[model samples]
Target: MVRVDRGLATTIGGAGVARVGYSGRILEAAADDPASGPCVGDWALVARWTDDRSTLEHLLPRRSCVTRAQSGGTSHAQALAANVTLAAVVVGLDQTPAITKIERLVALAWESGAQPLVLLTKADLAADAAEIAADVLTSAPGAEVMCCSCVDATGLSEVRDRLGDGTMALLGSSGAGKSSLVNALVGADVLATKEIRADGRGRHTSVRRELVVLPGGGCMIDTPGLRGVGLSGGEGIAATFADVDALAAQCRFNDCSHESEPGCAVLAAVEEGTLAVRRLESWRKLQREAAWVARRTDARLRAAELRVWKQRTKGSRGHPKRR
Candidate 1:
């Protein structure tokens, strides 16, 4: 599947096919022969081309993936997307973005095996860019926070120069100026913008996950505004708050939950003020979601294993049971 980078699909489907439009999402193979290899995931991107021309080719192996349990209470991990290099979460100065949201995205991005970058939008609207950016940095913990006023050419140029030639995804709540930043970085106003609400909440702009190529060189994947970001699995959570994770390892219990445990270094760090209480809470929240999802995924995996064992046993018995 092509990455969401808006670049034209690079064709490699053999002699008969022509690659056209490309997106990183890989739609599950509706029909397949299992004998050939392992099954691909169900939710894959539709790499489109001139009618009947586009086809799913080589699957870009995911270096890391963002997943959550299906809401239907099934033991399944539905992947949000894959093969991302950077998780670029945008925030606007016009009462739009929050440090907590950026933190949440940073945790998710860290789990996805991608670096996190916090893009501060509408810098011109802010009276104090440093104060706001500093807050974002505190939440993101060593993430790159660049401020840009889409109305200006210089700030936009710096953003483009840095984001150029990489695979980065833009994520933020609505009215965060994600779309505007994308247009500015691409060196063209290709994306549409809308006014934020009087209350400073985001109004929806992007509707789906689409990738666009920046004129400066990198691929930018823009997604629809998220309704919520609850994570599952100890994944990126552990990575994002690595200091906490490392400290937790010093705890007495091998599987320490780091909650009220004796010899809990995590708690000690909290007591000593080495870690922020809010960050710990964010980590715990994500860890809980991930653990719940993992249990569901494990159940599904076990059931699949049982089914396979039963099939093999039945087939062997039918073949005049081995002596």
Candidate 2:
């Protein structure tokens, strides 16, 4: 990227930048700041660059955004990426793939207005990669699940068949060989990767969530390993866990938590083995986390909205607005 205006100028990168143009950050633009650098592959307002003017003027609007609940404070959804057309949930087959975790991430991706794909890597390590792939299909409906190993051309071919010429995000816990997969596909080890004990976990390699391009032609954004992804609480949550949510809707009380609730269809499904108990439990846990995030986000949003209204009210009443 060519340096321009300290941080307010424009960047001209090949391919990736050309495909997805620049837009400034939302929170920064909300505060009316001109220069906070463009938010990469995210929703932003874009303005024309004129000879007389140095800053952007109009917001192009975001196609979609991925977010998580505030980590520690009451804050609205933090935007992960904007205009993401596809999201690939990376799962390692070396160990039992947490279907729930995959679901939660998919939920976030769906919430962001992006279609989700499931990529199960490390077929060489998993006892039965094909079987696990089948299980993944059952766990997440309407998703493309691929079991692949970068060890050979066949596996690479399988993976290449899925990714299209669009922006796709790679999300999974570290050691899933996301970096390796990216390298193999690109026909080089351009991205850095490490190998630890296959059986053991706990080596923080990727720290920040940044976007990188796969060598071929498509682009991918690699994110830091997330221990948990909290949903922002909305239609996406219901859509991702439609099975559980549908059953919950059938309960006698709309406020049913599915725990000792009368006429709880969700619990009944668990009993009948129609829904895996573990899956139900996972859904419940995510619901709880989503609810928490919603509450915090609502609180944050309400505060900001109220402050805006308060300022207008004070200005109308001939009183100086409170700082």
Per-residue accuracy of model 1 over 252-304 as CA lDDT, tens digit each: 89888888989888989899998888878877777777777777767867887
Candidate 2, residues 1-323: lDDT per residue as tens digits? 21222235243333223222334443356444222234446433344355433343344466765666545544544555556777778887777887778888878777877888888888888777888889888777776788788875437776675566777777788888777777778888766777756666736677655566666666666666767566776666677777777788888888987889878898899898898888887777777777777677677677879988988987888787644
My TM-score estimates for the predictions, one after another, are 0.75, 0.79
What's the distance in Å from true for residue 256, model 1? Answer: 4.7
In model 2, what lDDT does residue 33 have? 24
Candidate 1 residue 163 C-alpha distance from true site, Å: 1.7
Model 1, position 278, has a per-residue lDDT of 84
